[model samples]
Target chain A: MNALNLLRIAVKALQRNKLRAFLTMLGIIIGVAAVITMMSIGEGSRRSIESNLTSMGSNMITISPSSNSPGVRMSGSSIQSLTVNDVIALRNQATNLTAVSPMVSASGQVIKGALNWSTSIQGASPEYLDIRKLEVSEGISFDESDVRSSAKVCLLGKTVIDNLFPNGENPVGQIIRFNKIPFQVIGVLASKGQSGFGQDQDDIIIAPYTTVQNRVLASTYFQSIFTSAISEAASEAASEEITRILRETHRLRATEENDFSVRTQAELINTLNTTMGMLTALLTSVASISLVIGGIGIMNIMYVSVTERTREIGLRMSIGARPVDILMQFLIEAILISITGGVIGVIIGVSASVLVSGILNWPTVISEPSIVISFLVCALTGVFFGYYPAQKASRLDPIEALRYE
Target chain B: MSKILEIHDLKREFKVGSEIVRALKGVSFDVGTGEFITIMGTSGSGKSTLLNVLGCLDKPSSGTYLLDGVDLKSLNRNQLAQFRNTKIGFVFQAYNLLPRTSALENVELPLLYNPSINTKERRERAIQALEAVKLADRFDHTPNQLSGGQQQRVAIARALVNEPVMILADEATGNLDTRTSYEIMSLMQELNQVQKKTIVFVTHEPDIASFSSRTIMLRDGKVQKDTPNENLQSAREALNSLPVTEDY
Candidate 1:
């Protein structure tokens, strides 16, 4: 018989018991839906993290001093190995670096006409703003002359302005006292809503590194050094240059371990991507178990159908239907059930992903590959589970089947 | 008359749990075209076995059987199925029509296995066969909606749809009442006489056997008698003489 006639026969047979066929398909629907939803959620999170990191300068690099003693538990914050001289060495020698700056910080209470606020005072060269992708929205920025003179002029972030100048006063030229030392506000830094790690990027102040290190902290050592590469692809080369120059400036011997670490924004993005990819793989595997169970359901129903239709098979055989024809008929029936289930599953999964994103406020990306893979898996599942039953029906003895009640 | 079928020393054995049951022991028979023959036997008389062999449903263990000039023994499983489709028509005692299927579809069953017959031709042939059995008006009725006699007629229509060389019936009237049985027998008689269709009917009733021109009696896996009937009764006359019921 032709394939079309076989398909028609299979459909007619399934139509006899519509409820049973639908119930059999439910298993596959849920399985495929779960797989798609999980994959979308995972991919959405990875992309969101990448974009958030990229917003903060994808070519940015950070160099922090490692603990002096490897066996001792000391925070990198207390380490004083990085200095202004190392930043100068990198600025002079590193060809891959687009910009470089020394970082120093001191937390203290700032008072502006009795409107006092607690915030950290971060000190760096004017080039620090370019390296960190921060823009000055109003007024002028302190230049290299200000750093050489150890001037006390500062820039106010949006959070500090909101707290210290609550009356909407133009604080660009206003004077503020940090730790009882008066300083003039030179500019207002543009708003950077928040970092990916939940840190408020706008809750700080920026000044010349000389001012914070010599006047506020009374320390000559720097906390960290920040730099940017010419491009994201060049960050690795830039980091290597920093390491070599810092090692030479520290006068470290070739045999000794360097007391500093260099890290790039790309490394952070890769770590997060790996973690989320693992999570997606784990969830997708669990959901595929349901697909397997759905296949079993198809096999079980096919077995029952074969048993129920033994007499019909016998009648068809007597009328000259070959064994292969009977096999194709049943096989086609099982495939139809699974393929239909797969299509419905893809629809439900996409909708479910959208619903989850809307209700739970989670990021979800419905990728095309996940849908296509689910469909192929459903078709394969049908063939794998449906084969034996169809074979069993095809091998049935016509005489015995005719006698079957 | 040209010979439609020939069987020589046909024997079939069944292995029932290490015991060999000889169902047909060297049975031999030949049937000519347009002949109406009946095979009669009691229970366990091996008449059913002979019928199965004749229908190509079971191959004899040691025999030579030919139908429509093709060697039955030389054909494989698929070939036998094709042979049955093209050369033989079968009617069963229970009127084995598919439930929930219309009479027309049931009649089209045999033609479906033949790839050369397209959908339109299949439908036309089915309708023509239904008309031949006087059931063209009720072609859309399912088996449940049809009377037992009407269902048998539909089964006969299905048998005739393929235009086979002969019709093989196993107790075709075994489930019918006397009046219904006579009506079916009359139809069969008309198909045999008017259309020149050959028929082989298997039954245990001598009264039914009287309607055919020849009777072959089987007893204990062997043919006990094969005789020509001198007084072949007309089933249409028999059906007409029966007293009409009150409902009619």
Candidate 2:
């Protein structure tokens, strides 16, 4: 028989038990929806992280002194191996280096006209703002002359400004006390919102490294060295050059391990992306189990249908339907159910992803290739599970089937 | 008249758990075109097995059976299906009409297996067959909506829809009352007489067998008697004489 006619017959048969058919399709629907939702969530998070990383400066790299002892645990920036001399050496030797700054961070209470807030204070050169992609919204950043003179001028991040100066007052040229030391606010840094780890990115104050080293924390050694590449594409080359320079300047023997660790933003992004990708794959695999279960449900229903319609099959055979015709009829019925389910699943999956994004405030990306792949999988599920039952129907002896009560 | 079917020494055996059961034992028969014949037997008399072989639903264990000019053994499974589609029609005891399907679509079923016929022709032929069976007005009715006699008529229309060489009916009137049985028999008689249709009917009822031109009585997997009826009864006259019951 022609495919159209066969399909019609199959539809008619399914129409006899609409509830059963719908229930059978529900399994596939849930399976496809789960897969799509998980994949979209993963894609969305990856994209979100990538954008955050780029905004934070994709080519930025951090060099921190490693822990000195083998058994003792120490904070990353506690070691005093990296210093301003290494930053100068990296700036001079690294080919693709655009900006190099020595960083020293300390948390302290800052007070402006009786408004007090505790915030992190970062001390670095004027180029630190450029390396960290921090733009000044008002006033000016501390210049190199300010760094050399140990000027007590600082830039306030938006969060810190809001907390320390709450009266909608621009803090430029205002004096704020950090650890009982008065410092003039040079500028208000632009808002960077939250980082990928949910930490507030705009809750800090930046000052010249010389002032922070001599006046605030009274530190002699630099905590970390931050550098930026000329372009994101050149960050890897810049990292290699910085490693060679730091190794030679630190005078580490060729056979000995280096006392510093250099990490590029690209590495962090790659690691996060890999983690997100793995999560998506794990979720998708779990969802595919449902599709398999759905296929089994179809097979179970098909087996029952074959048994219930044995006499009908016999009657058709007696009339003129070949074994292959019977097989095709049942197989096509299965495919029709699954394909319909798959289409509905795609719709539900997209909607569910949208709903999740809206309600939970999570990012979601609906990919077209995933939809196409799920459809193909649904078709395969139909054929794979429907085969045995259809084959059983086809192999039935007409005489015995006709005799079936 | 040319013989429509010929069977010589046909044997059919079944293995029931290592025990051989011979369903048909060396039965031989020839049926001419336009002939109305009845094969009568009790349950387990092998009439059903013979009918299956005749309908090409089963192959005889050992025999030289021919339908028209083609050897039944020479045809493959697919060819046999085609042969059944084009050359034979079957009527079952339960009517075998698909539930929830319209009478017209049920009749169009046989034509579906015939790829040579298009959709429009299939519909037209089905309507014509239903019209021939006097069910044109009930074309859209399902089997549940029709009476037993009407359902049987629809089944007969389905059998005739493909314009087969012969109609094979197994207990066609077995589910009907006397009047309904008589009504179906009358319809068959009309088709045989006016349309020159070949018919082979199987039944256990001797009264039903009286309407045919010839009767073959089978017992214990063999034909006990094969004789031509000298005086064939008219089912129309029989229906007229019977008392009418309330329409179902």
Candidate 3:
């Protein structure tokens, strides 16, 4: 028989078992939905990190003390050569330096009216806020003079303010003690909660580097050093300048390896993108196991259908249909089921992904290629898995099959 | 008379396990133009196998079979299907109509297999065939909804829709009551005689065999007897002597 007749016959057969057909379609639906949803989640997480990194200026670079920066791991004590003098040198000498800030952090308890918070203490100059693109919410930030004269002033992060002052009372100009020394709150840093590392990003207080060094903690070594390039085109030059300045300030003689490493925000973005892309691919692949299982289900059901309709097959064959005719009929039936299911699956998968993104408040984009590929894969699966049963139906002996109960 | 179908020394065998089971041993027959011939046999006598072979559903193990002067053995699979579509029709014991299709659509099946007939022509021919079988009013009724005799008539309509040279009936009335069976047999008889269409029916009942003009009996895959039904006149006289059954 021709293709039209075969398709008509197949559609009629499928309609006869509507419930079974729908149940089989459900498997493909769930598989496709899971695949799309997982990929969207992974994409959402990556976008979250991207926006976070973007909010902190993309032209920024970080310079930290390192040892040789080669195959061998750096011993923590061996990489402490970075200093404030290096920051001053880069700011003055580098042609593309926009702003330079030397960072030093101290984790200590702050006390006020029985409300205490073990908050991170960040020490930097007023230039830190401009380069890092932070805005003071309620009070002014510290200036260069404060850093030079070791002013007894502080800036509280949003989380620290909330934790220590539960009544939402303003703490600007109010005296709070850190490490048993009293310092007035000079500013309130802007809120930047939940960094890419899942850490509470705004849980800190800021102070002048000299004040932190002299009164808050007597620490000779500092945390990561920070700087910013003048423009997107100038980030590379600025990073190199920081490395050169730090190397010279530390007085690393000839035949000695530089102890500091400089990295750009663009480099961090690339690394993160590659890692998250791999994660997305892995998750999507894991979800494909369900699609394979759905293919197996189609194969199993087709075999039973062929067996059940053996007598009908015999009758058709005897009328005029050839073996190839019979084969095409059943194969077309299988493909119709799978292709219809795949179309429904694509719609359901995309919708479910959107639903998940909406509920979780995450960014997600479903690519068109994913939908097209899903359709092709599922239809081809029907051909591969449904082949054996359709062949069995075609190859049946008419004389014997007609006698089959 | 012009011969429409001729089978010469047809033999068929099957490999059942390690042994060869001989189903037909050189069975030979000829069907003339508009002939109604019945082949009678007991169980395991290979009459059904002969019907399948004649319908191009099976390949004879050896020997030649010709329908409308085209050697069936020489035709490829596709060619045989075309031949079956245009030149041969089959009516089986169980009324093997597609249960889901309406009687009209079931009758249109063979026309669909032949592309020369377009949709409009196919539908018209199907309606005409249904009318010939006296089921025109019930064209939309499915096979399951029709009674056993009506179902058989619908099957005959499906078989006749292609307007083939011959209608091969294999126990066409086997599943019906005596009255319904007679109704179906009368329909077959009308097609063979008034329509001048050749027919080959396979049955075990003597009364059914008497309806045909000739009889061929088979025993153990060979023809036991081949003779014209000279007693058909007496059988008709005796039938009229009995009683008037339902008109149906």
Task: Quote the positional error of residue B182 for candidate 2 in Å.
Answer: 1.4
Off by over 4 Å in 2: A68-74, B245-248
Report the C-alpha lDDT of model 2 over B1-248, residue by residue, as the tens digit. 89999999999999999899999999999999999999999899999899989999889999889998789999889888898999998998999999988999899988888878899999999999999999879999999999999999999999999999999999999999998899999999999999999999999999989999999999999999999989999999999998665874
The per-model DockQ list reads 0.70, 0.76, 0.46
- Residue pairs in steric clash, candidate 1? none
Q: Candidate 3, overall lDDT?
A: 0.82
Order the numbered candidates by lDDT, best leading: 1, 2, 3
How would you encode candidate 3's per-residue C-alpha lDDT over A1-405 as one tens digit per residue? 557767876887788789998787777777777777777778878888888887887888887766675687766434567666777688788887778887787778899879898876888878878777788988888887888899989888888888888998888989988877888998888888777778886887788887887777676566667778888678877777776667678877777787777889988988999999999989989888887888888888899999999988877766667778889888987888788888888888888888877886777878776777778888988899889999999989877787787
| Interface RMSD list for the candidates | 1.0, 1.0, 2.2
DockQ sort, best first: 2, 1, 3
Task: Please list the residue runs of candidate 3 whose C-alpha ends up more than 4 Å from where it truly belongs after superposition.
Answer: A57-59, A67-79, A92-98, A109-117, A138-154, A163-187, A214-222, A229-245, A248-255, A263-286, A347-373, B13-28, B43-45, B116-122, B219-226, B229-248
In candidate 3, how many Å is residue B93 off?
0.5
Q: Which lDDT tens digits does candidate 3 get at residues B1-248? A: 98898889999998999999898999998889989899999988988788888888778999999899988889987787777778888887888777677889788877766767777898899999999999879999988889988888988988898888889888888898776777777777788878999999989999988888999999999998999998663333443455675864
Q: Largest TM-score belongs to which candidate? A: 2
Q: Give the Å error, residue B101, model 3.
A: 4.4
lDDT of 1 by residue, A228-320 (tens): 999999988888888899889998898877788899998888898899899999999999999999999999999999999899998888889
lDDT (tens digit, per residue) of candidate 1 on B1-248: 89898988889999999999999898888999999999999999998888888888889999899998788989999998988888889999989898888899889888988888999999999999999999979988999999999999999999999999999999999999999999999999999999999999999999999999999999998889999999999999999999999965
User: Could you tell me the lDDT of residue A333 within candidate 1?
Assistant: 93
Whichever of 1 and 2 has more TM-score, that candidate is 2
RMSD over all Cα atoms, model 2: 1.9
